[model samples]
Target: MVAKLRPYRRPAIILAITAIGAAAIFLGRPAIAEAAAVDGETEFVLNTFAFLIWGALVMWMCAGFTMLESGSVRTKNASMICLKNIGIYSIAGLAYFVIGYNLMYVDVVGDFIGSFNLL
Candidate 1:
């Protein structure tokens, strides 16, 4: 029995050593609260960065939708779908460039509406 089990001993010892090392590393690491002490300005910057990333991803979703729709539709209608998607996104971009940015950022003291000035 001993001779039969001798071949597995080396592999078992290696696995045990690896597990102990992993455990030590995990135990020695700092807690999340201690490592994530973001200041107010840093928090603001992070928030702005997150918004930019979210906006970019949202804009790119139009292309993704176009691809998905064109691929799922018939060959005869795929071109039409792609064109429609492109046109819609172009108009949306123009509108946002012209008015959306101003509306979002400019100081308007109204409770429900913003100024019409170009921002």
Candidate 2:
């Protein structure tokens, strides 16, 4: 019987060690007091930085599209293509900020009605 159990000893010990570690995790878990939690100003700064980084990524995509179009077209038309992209982006940015934003939260359900979230 001991010989038969010999092969299983290593597996059992490994499982025991992992179980011990999992139990110990709660002891070392990080805790923060409500008073020490992040404030509104800190959250605002973080949100602004996140928006800036996202806007930068979008600008890179716009640059890539312009480059692709410029590389494919004739030399004379390259400037026109660049101008067209700039114009479109400018108009879209203006419209989104000035008008599109106000329409987003109008008469919406789901979260507003304490219901399930949707895609």
Candidate 3:
């Protein structure tokens, strides 16, 4: 039984490692905290709840993106394309977390992209 299960375990381990690495990359970046003071309890609660909702919505979007792209593309290329999209998303997430988010929110230079702060 152990010998039979060994083949299946490698994929699971790889998935676990990928998830850990992605989480580490995301959490290691500097996050932009709300700078403005919360005037009331209502605002605080609303903001927190809004973000929670946004997280769900974004996850839904990822599913939608996968389905839409997979459905639209040729059958032969679907897996390859989906993997590409996943990789692109991971890279974009890391890039945005590290630089893009800060550039957009903090210390705006003008209407365009904000200045780079390598914090």
Which candidate has the top score in TM-score?
A: 1
- In candidate 3, position 27 carries an lDDT of 85
TM-score of each: 0.55, 0.50, 0.46
Better of 1 and 2 by lDDT: 1
**Colliding residue pairs in candidate 1:** none
Q: 1-119, model 3: which lDDT tens digit per residue?
A: 89989999989999999999999998887764544555677786887689779968986798789889899989998998789888977897799789876775576767376766666
Give lDDT for model 1: 0.86
**Which lDDT value does model 3 have at 19?**
99
TM value for model 3: 0.46
Model 1 off-target regions past 4 Å? 1-45, 109-112
Q: Where does model 3 exceed 4 Å of error?
A: 1-42, 100-118
Model 1 lDDT tens row, 34-109: 8878898888788879989998999788789989999999999999999999898889889988888777766787
Whichever of 1 and 3 has more TM-score, that candidate is: 1
> What shift in Å separates residue 54 of candidate 3 from its native position after superposition?
1.4
Residues 16-116, model 2: lDDT tens digits: 99999987986566655433678888987887789779989999999999999999999999999999999999998888666554454234554443322
Supply candidate 3's per-residue lDDT for 10: 87
